[model samples]
Target chain A: MGRKLLLEHINVPGINTLEVYRKTGGYRAVEKAIKTMSTDEVVEEVKKSGLRGRGGAGFPTGMKWSFLAKPEGVARYLVCNADESEPGTFKDRYLMTNIPHALIEGMIVSSYALGANTSYIYVRGEMMPQIRILEKAIAEAKAAGFLGKNILGSGYDLELYVQPGGGAYICGEETALLESLEGKRGNPRIKPPFPAIAGLYGCPTVVNNVESIAAVVPIINDGGEEYAKIGIGRSTGTKLISASGNINKPGVYEIELGVSVEDFIYSEEYCGGIANGKRLKAVVAGGSSVPILPANLILNLVNGDKRLMSYESLSEGGFTTGTMLGSGGFVVLDEDQCIVRNTWNFSRFYHHESCGQCSPCREGTGWMEKVLHRLENGHGKMSDMDLLVDVSKKIEGNTICPLGDAAAWPVASAIRHFRDEFEWHVRNPTLAVKENFGLAHYADPLPELVS
Target chain B: MLKVEETQSVEFSTELVNKFAEIVSRYPEGKEKSALLPILHEVQAVNGWLSSVAMDKVAAYLNIAPIEVYEVASFYSMYFLRPQGKFVLEVCRTGPCCLVGAEKIIDYIGEKLGVKEGEVTADGLFSYRGVECLAACGFAPVLQIGPEYTFYENLTTNSVDQLISDLKDKASKS
Candidate 1:
């Protein structure tokens, strides 16, 4: 097994409770940072660790923190993005539901580093149980002198609260999250002021993903040098990959970065290969928003190099022949699955969650969904394929938020990689409605249950 | 719509008022309006859903305009504008779940409950709607009900039938 930083103690009984978590060496990071280390020291160590944001964007966490503007007497804030609504990405929910204290401990250290006295975790409202657990954990931390005034005999003080969103996927974007936190609609703001400069009611704020914040505890505990030695060159840490879709052992598994895609899929330790001995057709390696890769492209690159699950390796072809590791959602599709139907499902999601801020996104998403619906159900013409490409291109970079690109990329990628399937639907309109594009070279025939 | 709307004089229970105060205290001194989301949640829990009257009370409690509350409430998928069944079944219909059999499960819940999407059953016991990803893709075909969002994962037609029966039994006793 690789070094499991975040999930090392995940299966420990009562780990959710404060007393049990404390017994398991929790909150040591807070003591370490608050007692011996300076704010710059903590930030410097994280920078050395090369820890990128685990929340899709993969921005460097330390760089993001250093950008926090410290205007005289202006209070800065650290907001945790717990709105884990991205399809196929559930690692945050698992981390919070099972080990609530990890996030709390990390939040305290992260807050101290940024010189913020107040922080809020904006969790998706649907996750009420996890929110309750976090609230309990926060109360326990406050009672134990880790939070609230003068923590651990240090002169620093921080107050953290759990804020619930009204359940909009667009709120996962940092600015929209800030807007939602301020009790407004979840509309993403235009950037240049970037939350690090002016956020959360005109004060500087830093919003980090739930996994990224929790990963800081381990970074502080082991020291950044040691943490940097765990994963490959750039991907210098363990990542929690949420394995789902047609897999035997489908759940969150912590793997060292740069593990070969072949090993991650076929090895018994990770996904335990495809389910029911079926052949793999395609895999949305990251979350739904990333480009979907066919099974062949996933195992080997266009350059004939074996593919590794690293940022550099995954995006080698740059949205043309390769996909990014966007949140490590790892959704696998078997041969029997229909790409058109799956693309339609994602289009419907974008349409339902467009936020209606920009006309390109708001209107383009609905049109794409309608077109994809026609394409999926066999009521499409040849021009509909070109129409899909055109619409997705229009929505790609024309919006204030990445939600537009999110809606567009999957449709574009689906057509780019699987054009024959889309054509098959139009050619055999009646047959397409009655049947799926079955295992035609995409699926490898199996002799046994184990892939 | 409870008395929060008609009379403009009805007050929330003492316990709920205290709870709201405690939550509002988490924000900055004058920014208690940040507690609007949680307060709206409490309003929905106390009342079946957020009526105009309930929203007006929430607006008054937060000292913000009712339009602010309405804009926010309408933006989120969680808030219900009208009365729903005692139990709202929100099934995931996004990509990962659909790859596994979420669409079938959504249909199964609809047929068994005799309710179309967003419609409450005649007995006022069940309401079904399809939702975006619930972030539980590993266990596809997941549904959750509010107040706690209790998740029912790896669902099938048979399981949906059993869940409907279980909720019906609970509703009948209440």
Candidate 2:
């Protein structure tokens, strides 16, 4: 039943239309939430339901809604963080492309909860085609009177706009995104005023990710308590995971939050097992930003008791063995993959995407990237291994945003778990060279084409 | 915040306006701001780069705040805030592309055009900048001419020279 909660109405004929969505119990949440429940009651329902932010951080959704500066004379905004730029994550794209109305409907209901008048969907600029699709859906929603002044005889006035970010990865951070939305650079600002106090035109604003808002529709429609009953413990409700890398069937999977990591990988029910029948070597449980775990650590039960995927349980082992459930981008690594090489790939992405605002991140990312690049290219000294660790340590926790930490985590974790791989590469560079890096598509015609 | 200059006038030509109107008709009513990206895109397409005047006119047409229009235009890497040359070459200088001498291509172009990375040529014929993920990973090193994302696969010094020559030839004719 939880296999497709977010993507439930996806396959229905013409489900893209407001009429069809309404027929299938769409906007029922708004009807129930607006006409019946008070805004405080609605927020309480969400809080009691234990619904967490589905956009990686797993922050309590209702609690976040509670943070808004009450309906003051000043206007508040609901910003949907649709800038899904995490490596190995593409579920938000699917939501935007196939079932945009779900997101739009959710936006209306959620905006009502926080007493917001204007909402913006800050989508990544790279997703040009998906943005076009969402634009059409939003237009349809407005035409049906689901948006704008007076909605379904309710006097709630709301306006939705789609803003395309300049494709900076740092914009995924809420403060940075708000800055970018304000027609400036996408560099993140330190939080104190928080978006809830002063955001977007210096008014209280609520920024929730794409999946986080979409989940709110169902929570309100089916009673948040009932939604909470599905998943175990504090890891309530379902999670939309974007699984990729070495897996046989890599794509988006919506599952009850506490499903075991092993079940997700080995069970035919999820992911269809690893591709090429290769043995799993490691898994980056969350996005590349999280730590990477070796296969043995993931298979073993926590404290040798339970094998679980809940936020608390998964992170129990910390970066030493378990990875963060951040963003649910499960990128698995096959045995053929080299940990050093893969870690370098992640470091390289962060280095390129760094906003260059914070000194530590700006200087440290470059140093780490240069060290990793030299090591990966088979030109490494033993001291370079220590240097990589040293650079990552300096970069993490020293920046204005989580991006510096996100960039540093993979490098630090990879070295921690697979120092031998780096040592091997340093000891015998030629031996470490594989005939093929297993790139999907190689420029040389002799290599297999991806498309 | 930008006031449209009297000389530039911040108004669209008939051709760009027609394209903009056509795009607007594609969306539902009251969501005209959705066309903001495409409108700015069309302005950039016709006017080379988005001048402050052009952005203001676009803001007026979309009925969004001038700041909103400017935000979209500036946020995207593709949109040029300042003026660019007739041929703007954006070299992909991140990861896979950088692994195999995207820097060399930039160097070659700089030497050929006699301008630094962010500088437009004195003749206003060429400008260069570094970018990320042109989505041509297999190509290793790639560059785009204006908005035309051209991938130069398996690049060498000679191959880049050929591409420059080809671009120059095409620009001269067009």
- The top-ranked prediction according to lDDT is 1
On residues A204-304, what C-alpha lDDT tens digit does candidate 2 reach at each position? Answer: 98999898888888888888888888888888888887776666666677888888888898777678887787777777787778888777666554355
Off by over 4 Å in 1: A443-451, B1-11
**CA shift at A23, candidate 1, in angstroms?**
2.0
Worst 10 contiguous positions by lDDT, candidate 2 chain A: A441-450
Candidate with the greatest DockQ versus the true structure: 1
TM-score of chain A of each: 0.97, 0.94
Candidate 2 local lDDT, residue B136: 39
Write model 1 residue lDDT over A1-451, tens digit each, in one string.
7889999898899999889998999999999999999999999999988999999999999999999999999999999999998899999999999999999999999999999999999999999999999999999999999999999999999999999888899999999999999888889999888888999988999999999999999999999999899888888898999999999989999999999998999999999999999988999999999999888788877766888988889898788778999999999999889999999989999999999999999999999999989988889889998999999999999999999999999999999878889999999999888798976655332212112
Residue B17 error for model 2, in Å? Answer: 6.5
DockQ of 2: 0.13
Would candidate 1 be rated incorrect, acceptable, medium or high by CAPRI criteria? high
Q: In model 2, what are the clashing residue pairs, if there are any?
A: A56-A327, A166-B75, A248-A275
Q: Model-by-model lDDT, in order?
A: 0.90, 0.75
Residue pairs that clash (backbone atoms under 3 angstroms), model 1: none
- How does each model score on TM-score? 0.97, 0.78
